[model samples]
Target: MADYLPRAPWTQRDDLHRMVDALGNAPDGTSLARWVGGAVRDGLLGEDAADVDCATPLKPQDVMARLKRAGIRTVPTGIDHGTVTALLPGGKVEITTLRRDVSTDGRRATVEYASEWRDDAARRDFTINALYADPRTLEIYDYFGGLADLAVRRVRFIGDARQRIREDHLRILRYYRFQARFGSALDSEAEEACAELAAMLKGLSRERVAMELLNLLGLPDPSDTLLRMEQRGVLGVVLPEVQRPAIEALPTLIGAERQAGLAPQAIRRMAALLPLSPQVAEGVAARLRLSRAQRDRLACVAGRQADDAANPLALAYRCGTECAQDRLLLCGGDPAPLSDWEIPQLPLKGGEIVQRGIKAGPEVARILRAVEARWISEGFPDRERVLRLLEAELPA
Candidate 1:
């Protein structure tokens, strides 16, 4: 029900008040600081905003000096970029000076501070993100039609869509991400602009692209937005390795994940969007510059084919609990056995087998492996039963 004003509880916290109070001694607290960007946008939606950022007309150094004079602790997090972080008792607030982009190269932008609030808002990517709130006035400021856009769940570019994208190609990915999280549907103009300039995405770093795509995949159900991206050729521009068949298989995995009471993971969903081939998964993972652990996990689930009736606990012991769940859900296998089962290490050892009168050589190792295999096949029996099984492996 918040409109034209933000009623976020974090704004009323005493720590935040202390931080803002340090910014200025104005009677109404104007001309000092106002909450900006995601905090304001999410707050107005009746959601608890985790990150509370602010904008001030004062330069970063001056703001730091003021905070220090008021006994406030400040970190020069991005001082060169006109951003300073004020540590409050409740949380840290990122205080950035109002700035306008001086130039952009479709990757990074050079910015210069400006006194006018609108100048700062103009440089933002989307209208809904341009919302701002004055701490003292208790009034929300909409330089663009952000409030109206929020009302209709529409995400529109601040100015020309193509120009906004040209300024930074990352906006194309951001548009889809925002649409998946906030907007009820895709904006045709924004979608078309992204398609027209989709090639510019090649200019971005692989890390950034992977981050956005993984974030999108992490959503509960991004099937519609993903399908739109595929239709628009936007997804293909970044990840051509994902063929249509694999992408189509995502919904089934999503449903299986839901039925099995498991949360959707970004990497798991990404693994679902590829053929069941470890080689293919490894190749795509390397291209995206994924971390070693992530690359290995993708490989683990990619080549695996889980039977619906297979022992999920055994699979968990083999690859990992997470990988087992992923393979089962992706392959239409049941993972209920892992719900309460605790994976146990083999109780019998090679030394125990050697003491059973077997030669202390290759045959002992072979017997130990055979006994371990039998133990696993029997669903991991007690230590006594394992010893008996090892006795059976020894030469008579």
Candidate 2:
């Protein structure tokens, strides 16, 4: 029992109090209290808290009713699991009733509500995430030695690692992400468990696996973890096309420091390593439920190789400004140097070519391409030079 006052800002403290007050007035004796997750870990690490999740003894319906009484919008985010999302001005808070897993098929779990906080913490994936904090007092309640594991920077599963993985195969990838993000060392039991259950990852849906892999790549040193997963045959089973060549080339493709930024460009750089066909990539993206923009950007990056930078202006023009910038950054190129060259704007249009008696066919496109190439070669001269080139190419 570590007594730490709630160090969250006044606004957050007020919000928590608001929720707790609402929970207190609910029909059931259940009251809202802070539960384990990023809030507790980030509070201890002095990192900015992104989301606050609370646990209440009240059932989902009761929680919703209380929120309605408080004039807060409540969404049934996971009604089956007794989770409701409360929308707030700055951010949203997810409040879930304490639950215990009754049955699980390593994909989804069937849960039953519990009145005790210890039951909820015990059911979580890792110990570091099992520590709960009091919303009003900000006191931490550790049912397991999560605080000890956090202080020692060790990632230990709550119960048996193998059993936990069988409960949810996605935890394997989550374990890697946690290790990479928190800079924690994995215990032998956990490591062995990961290796043993690596093959079970195939049972997970591609979308789920993809989401977890993306999160893993967001870590500081995802490469090492990815390599370990690959060595243990987990990567191949889940993603068969990601071979050693591409994995080895990832470090060179995107430096570790930049990849740690967790930008879309970093994701693209890493995705390029997979030897997936265009159709396969599209399928994978669809299965993973990736946004259209993400799929397109990743496809664009994968289509181009490092040695394809012979025509810098053409590359910039084809890839657009942002993608070009990302590509340069991924390749460790100085973006400042290339920032000055403006994309060559054509002076003449297809209509102008037709007006000049040139056919509106392949030749029109060829003429424009030639003029644009000449403009680029001449270091993108003034509009006057562009006009002159267009005039020369399509003389009236």
Candidate 3:
């Protein structure tokens, strides 16, 4: 495996080199650590990976002691889970001792640290994620058929898919998320397992579910995966409020997004994938425990009506370019001219309304709204024309 595996970019960094040099051998004469999980998986796929996690056979305390003795900083990020974070100069790497699941209640797992790498790999969710790379030798250790799976871009769960889902229901969603990024086809066994356990998703926290769902939605085009989720009844359990019509609109909306050169936005994509009425959006926000910003964005995009986006300038004035363009995409209309549309501020100031002998209370606001509507309706006429329109709307 070492002969075929290319050295990942992170392996060349000085910090990783020193970390490897410092912990090459453990106290019990076991090999110290091997780069594992996403870092190894992505490197083999020829993608630049940010997180570099490692697996070690040493106990947590011994792992800490070795790093400390070698003058490396250590953080007990998940000590009870046999995990330690080694902070290096250029970056940080998470190193966890081998562990086997002792018990699981769907949402949480209890584990006992073990020295066997196979036990660690067995506990992982997917075959690709179980691949390990020796930092010292650049050799990939594939206890499972991870190398074969990666070669064909398959995203299958390790062991019995149903049993894995029973341990952590979140893997149900994770199955789709990983597929959205790396897989070409869904495994029938994994799909059946996920479908059977779809209802169990509610046991997971709203925040965790939201984060994973949003990650899935953030892919360049998640239409196919989303459709599969819908077919398997997963979407009905997760978001019953979403209708088939909204899900059907995704391909066109995604096509519009690509044509307009717009980046994938999770919230906007979410909006495109559901009925964006206030009540439904509110339900989504509450169910997902969305943040204030996320709630507001969803609400704002949901509040838009079809007529509001009919005109480019009016859309720009009311919703801003991004929001209006998203609406246009949702409507299956071209939004290329949006770039040429500029949002113009109301030419008349509040003081001007007051100066016109109008009381400075709600009357002033009323007159400004009236005048701005006239300005928008008239295609944002010049300031003088706007003033004349304002003159007629105010007290004679």
Candidate 4:
């Protein structure tokens, strides 16, 4: 299948050609670099790849020194793992020496450089990720039936599914994410291995877990994959806070987001997967090690309730535009009101209320609060309406 494979259009770029040329050739006169991993995988799928990584037989220092000779900047992003970052005119390309895993823990691998491309391919997590392409000929090299699996839209582990997951627990999450992004159905063998190794996820850093979950949630529709995770007892392991109610709530939230034309958001989805208790939400967000703003958003979504009968404008005004939208969507209310409309501030000021017969004291604050509530409840009408509200509250 690889032989019949034609060139990837993106490989024809001048910048990419320059990067390959800078890597030079081996003593055998063969090209030292080939485009590896996601770039090749996505190119075959006819979608643009976000990253274009390189594989070479040269050592890490050699990769760096050669790029340095060509006046190309390089960073030893993962030097120990034989990886370097090449800054090109178009974008950053990762250049790593061909390597085989010398040893493996659930977290990381110690690698030794290998001269053969197939040996390097053996260490990768998935079959689809192991494909490579020549920078010059643009011919794809599929070592482990990657093109076959990809043709069928199947995400398969390279060798043994359990062995692969044991090498890195993160691949468990990655399996689900890739399945959601590319596959029509989960690979049963891969799913079974992931389920068996689910407990290993607790060993991974919360930040890593959070990142993968968020990436999954950021997809167009991750509800099915998440449900599968819950069914397999994986979601409960990672996020014990997620209950059946949350499991049921996510599809509704996703539907509301689509109906309201709001983009899928990770934090909001995370909020939906927890009970509507601010304290529980706060604990979950903290456990995920989410950023301060994200934590606050989750807590707000949980803490505040959205009233479907309440005016959308007033909700957006009172709870803030973003939080209100999240709350509304979560609590079965309409979130579409703020889609085009900006939240407006209260039109009347305390000074205006005081200028009416109300004295400059706490009385002024009380009257303003009543008038502002009226203003907001009345769909935040113009100052003309606010003036009448202030008049009615004045000294009576």
Candidate 5:
């Protein structure tokens, strides 16, 4: 396992080495730090682990002071929760002191720092996430059978599933997200607990829920997990007002998206999970805090009609190649038009209509639009040819 550490991206850099070395030594000159969580899990799986988080025995202030003394930049990103971020040349490394839950209310937790590594491991939600590795010696630490669970492709909670969900309701979505990534069979206990607590997801902020849902949608093949979520009634809890037809279309849409070489997008997938309507897209965007661009794209994608976007010239001219390709993919039609469609600029302008002796009013606008339409129908004629066609419509 130690040999695997150096091969991971986090441990191969010198600056990270120096930062880890500095955080390892406490004020008393005793070494008490180890890399924990995803970095360790991904390293053992032979995946690229870039983000590094470490567990230390030092308290938040002590960790900050030690890094400050070493001339390293530090930020108290989650100081009350016993975590600080050190800015290194390679990237930011989050260092968290060992902690046990003092109290939890399903939405948040009050944490008390702990000195024991086992206690720290126990508080984490999942077994695979609690595994730790010593940075210097490269020793794997598994206090909760995480290595075994990882080997079998199981995603089980560290302790009782219900208790973990009670600590943070977001774990409900996380269960599915992790299942989409690393799970082969559902842990019956975890699945039951999630089904029971699916309603508690309402207490979580929409932004947080949106983030998790987006992440789950990003997986290479989330069709199985989504199908399970639908069957389990968990998908309805998050999107109560969604259209059933859209949900029914997901499996086919996902297959088409993959075949069309399109990367999974949350809004695009979410749009598929609702009735194809601009009104519904706007409502979902408002609820999820999606940015303006995301909201606009969702509206456009949902409003698209397959037959209308089938023509390469019209589709590319109006919606661009990307939108046209996405629409074709959603409608389960040929997407070849997007590869060859080239939009032509309109040859006539309002000023040019005014130059043609048309009055500077709504009539000038109308004339220009008429000429432009004719030009489009004529396969986009040149400026001179368009002006010649406009002669009849000019002032007469």
Candidate 6:
């Protein structure tokens, strides 16, 4: 055991103790033990805990009963892996029974429940993630010297890198994401492992690979790791049509954070670097599970590049406030504080045109466009200028 600090909050510690106490009364073959992932690693790294995961000695049914008796709501998030999500006041904890891989098809693992934490730790992906914590004492259980790796900021696979990559090809993308997010330096062994198995990424679903790539790009500094993936031939294999020029421009495009202050928009900026059609860009958004706003913004940015119209009112009306601002920022337009571009509102409507005896056909739309053009050219001053333009275009 290594010396560790109490990085978790008092509430989290109390919750863990409550869980352990409840498990202490569990019947034979229904006990609980803590196990892998973010909860343990983030705690040790002094980062805020997001989700807590555990391993129960109890079988799935038994674990459900015990957690229910303890008044914790249980969700069958993944029963196949003997995992149950126990909902607590502050957050939810994922508790899985100790298991060893019975079989794996390189995409999913078939696990067999065991009572030993060591067995479960051996089956995990990375050393740091394999670390477990004792809720009662707040002491970390390090079966793989994950503490040492954490201290040095190195990311290493639990065992053979190739074997791990072969087990799940998604780990290929995850490796770079981890390196970019937490790991200070990339391990040569890990890099070589990825290079050897880069083509295996083709075996994974495009949706899964696209999600991982989007997540990797969302990181603060993903350029180096992305470049590494590119060198390993993974990029070409996964998104073959994505040109090299855009890939090369990723560093500069994503380096300056956009003003939206959202990760998905940053992702859109990176995607915009690619020479893709609006339809292809929309497809990419759907493939990556990007939110609707992200999809719309990406389409708008792609379309805006081809539009040569400099009319402020036209730009504002089409792009809306948020996207218009984002576009101006990206195009190196003057940042004279957003207040300077107040768009003049149109007082006249299609109803007003009809009242003025203007025919309601394609000509109605044409006249409106003409009126807008004159308004835009006149600096879009006030309502008077707008009305004058409307009158000139739609006179009875």
Clashing pairs in 5: none
Q: 368, model 5: CA deviation in Å? A: 2.8
Report the lDDT tens digits of candidate 1 across residue range 1-396: 444556667878888787788888445537488888898888878888979899998999999999999888999999999999999888899999999999999999999999889999999999999988887666888988998898889989999999999999999999998998898855778989999999999989999999999989998888778888888889899888777777777898889889988888999988888777899899989988999999999999897864624777778888888788788887788888888877899897777766666668998888878987898889898999998997787777
Q: Rank the candidates by TM-score, best first.
A: 1, 4, 3, 5, 2, 6
Score each candidate by Cα lDDT.
0.86, 0.74, 0.84, 0.85, 0.81, 0.70
Using TM-score as the measure, which candidate wins?
1
For model 2, residues 198-294, the per-residue Cα lDDT tens digits are 8888788878887887877655456677777788777777767678777776666556335434343545645655654556666656767788986
Q: Which wins on TM-score, candidate 2 or candidate 6?
A: 2
lDDT measured at residue 197 in model 5 versus the true structure, 0 to 100: 82
TM-scores of the candidates in the order shown: 0.95, 0.87, 0.90, 0.91, 0.90, 0.85
Give the alpha carbon lDDT tens digit for every residue of 215-266 in model 6: 8777776777666677678767766647666666665545434432434345
Candidate 5 residues 175-202, lDDT tens each?
A: 9999999998679999999988888998
| Model 4 lDDT, full chain set | 0.85
What TM-score does prediction 2 earn?
0.87
Deviation from native of the Cα of residue 238 in model 4, angstroms: 0.7
Candidate structures ordered by lDDT, highest first: 1, 4, 3, 5, 2, 6
Candidate 6: list runs displaced more than 4 Å.
10-13, 25-31, 258-266, 279-294, 306-316, 321-326, 334-346, 374-385
> Which sections of candidate 3 miss by over 4 Å?
1-4, 26-31, 334-347, 377-389
lDDT of 2 at 219: 55
User: Candidate 4 on 9-31: residue-level lDDT in tens?
Assistant: 66777888877888898787768
Clashing pairs in 3: none
Encode model 3's per-residue lDDT on 176-269: one tens digit a residue. Answer: 9999899985588999999998999988999999999999999987888888899889988888877777777788877778888888889898
Report the error of model 4 at residue 93, Å.
1.3
Relative to the true structure, candidate 3 has a C-alpha RMSD (angstroms) of 2.6
What stretches of model 1 exceed 4 Å from their correct place?
25-31, 306-309
True-vs-predicted CA distance for residue 295, candidate 3, Å: 1.7
